[model samples]
Target: MRFFSQRRRPFLSVVICIHDMAREAPRTILSACCPYQKNVSPEDYEVIVVDNGSAVPFALRDGAGLSPAPRIVSMPHPRPSPVFALNWAARHVARGNHILFAIDGARIFSDQLIANTLRAHSICTDAFVYTLGCHLGPSVQMVSTTQGYNEDVEDRLIAESGWPAKPSALYNISVFAGSSSNGFWKPIVESNAFSVPRQLLDKMGGFHESFASSGGGLANLEIFARYVQRPDAKNVCLLSDMTFHQVHGGVATSAKVQHSTFAQEYFSIFQREYRFPSFDAIYLGPLRPEAAKFARIGLAE
Candidate 1:
């Protein structure tokens, strides 16, 4: 059953990949849908969620009652990596001229994400637009989990933050991820929420399928690097908007013994396949007072 249908093609297609996130998917979907996402109409974008072979598959009801409800696609035989699923969705399911990937489905977006992304696209259609990522705790989840953080703790944190009503409050509760800790002026290793023109994605072949590690390894970083390094692609970082990640026991974000092992493996694969270069971005979006501290984090150093 299709949850979304529009007369005209949407301007942006949001592709979100999930694996065993039944408890967290609903909130993530809501954060990306109407009402929660301010200033953007349902017709402006379409969300395509790929369930990468979870033990309990994600259903349509997860996004029930949401206008432009996410179109959930389940993979029957999924691989350890999400790259295959992401590529399939981008090539087959997406209908937008620009594709925005929230590769991790556990992220909750800032309200102005969609609207500001559209504004950035208007400024430069070929721009590679991305938002810095943050974790819903005192520190990054990998470290926070060691400090007694979990899904329950995250829920309480979100509840206390008064989000949706006070979407900007997310900044108050979240600390920037290590990749995005350097502030908006510096280059980030990767972005949890990022958009690129469909053509540019196609040119790069929609994420390398060889990133066979459980969480697509460093595939996200590779895509960001490729897009920013392109001479034709204008990298735009949204200073006001961000994606707040919930604790979901992810390969990289969770506190597990395998975390360091996975990191080394992924980095080795990345080094063997491509180079990791620091590429500066053209900062965009209105810097909200709530977000100013994060945006200027390392600027004085």
Candidate 2:
């Protein structure tokens, strides 16, 4: 998603879109807003929660802990396409030099996720940066973990611990594999969360709102493909940071339920597979001790 014109600010605005995630909303919002340390000043980053036509009307009350808190926006009607809500938010309310899109509303993030991303962006301003995706289950494996995803299991575990999400907990559960030459950080199939200069996304005409599919997978892939394919754009993957997905019967990631029909439809329309970035990621390696310490603060007990 993009904002038109040439307005630049020093800070970042994160837009998170949710359809119906009342239970997972609190944890997700808080996790993003409650980072322990910021590479940039707290005021440099803002979070925007877009309740895209959820039946329960997701609230921004959990954001009270932030210095400025997060702003809440809503879609006028329920739409199968998350793209509609995303474009709506980007058009009306985003205020940042760069905009980061987090499509899933039900995610608990590492404390270092935002700070680390900001650090990368500050260093490589022209680059497109994205977080390493993780799913919440027995471990913090990649989003496409073979164990699959189970919302019930995640809910029960979090409820028993009574902790929202903490650095230590995230560390304990994180899993890694060597898909690349180095160990640890592997190549990601898709990035659910990514950051880009507002102008760049705008130049691409924002998100294509034609996707009326269950989860807007085609829209996401199309937007990301353009970003990756840009020859001058550096693609940086924040290795230390990860976004832990909380299952909400996701149209794309729900392992138990297959989206073959949706996939076929998407293929027929595009005449190709959802293009994964062909380039290897710019990996800066593992989390530092100080960053890990800072991350611990985001967790709730």
Candidate 3:
């Protein structure tokens, strides 16, 4: 069902989680949303912009003259962490049957993104949320738009990485897939990618306070697997055709000390969940010692 802006109540809520975004990034997202809103019926959806403790404050209430004035909620603390920020954002606002987590950085992909996503949603049933593409590309440039069933941005690493995204392999796989970069779904307020229904959120007691930062992707995967494993709940669904991911290239590897920590922690989690061969033995290519050590720590735990 295609949506037009004038419709009153919406079935879905688009949530944009932000933390210390550069001056122009937020504007770009809003611009993208304007055209998106035009295509989507307001009766079927709304947009919520969560200011996750940006270093530079912005006009959330005013929308700085953006097409739609996003309901803005500022966190009490200026925490730079995405997970914490998103939780705080979801708690204060976001009203929709399903929440689409759209990252402000390089997460926005094409004009028909949301429309395409919901189209895929019509056919799937599982606890799994559908993620579109896995393209890791230039941060600022609007990558070429491709048509057809698959609209994902292509990544040079897919062939070389040699890692498969199997359900059981969620432990070993990197959460940094090309498709996961951008996704559409209900409010996954607990920091997990797949938004659990209100009942499950209460049951799980929200995200782990110990699991800090954006690396919760792996934690989320584990959660997704466990939750869907229940006999009564098999609603998780993965819609590969509707999503696309764009990896921002602004930050260099050396600049990612904090993210690396999360990566290390994830590897450890992977080790605990899976009895894969030695890290080096399983790796398709060379494994960094630090990366290997983190997995070892998880094993020791």
| Candidate number achieving the greatest lDDT relative to the actual structure | 1
Write the residue-wise lDDT of candidate 2 on 91-130 in tens digits: 7777787788887887666676777778778788777887
Clashing pairs in 1: none
Instruction: Tell me how far the alpha carbon of residue 271 in candidate 2 is from the true structure, in angstroms, after superposition.
Output: 2.4
Ranking by lDDT: 1, 2, 3
Candidate 1 residues 1-301, lDDT tens each? 2223343568999999999998778888988888888888889899989999998888856456676778889865689889888877877788888889988999988888989898899899788999999988999888889989998988888888887678888889999998788778877788999998876776665677667888877788887888888776588999799998989998888744364565576667656544555776788867889898797788788
TM-score of each: 0.91, 0.81, 0.54
Per-model CA lDDT versus the true structure: 0.82, 0.67, 0.40
The true-structure Cα RMSD of candidate 1 reads 3.5
Best by TM-score: 1
Question: Model 3, range 1-301, lDDT digits (tens) per residue?
Answer: 1111332334455666655544434433553355433355445555676666666765643355444456656667754345555555444455554455554333433344444334434444223243333233332123322221111333333334331221112122223232233222321211222443333444544333444544244444434444544445534333322222333432221134454565566566555542111110011112233123222432333
On lDDT, the stronger of 1 and 3 is 1
- What's model 2's TM-score? 0.81
Rank the models by TM-score, top first.
1, 2, 3
RMSD of each: 3.5, 6.0, 13.5
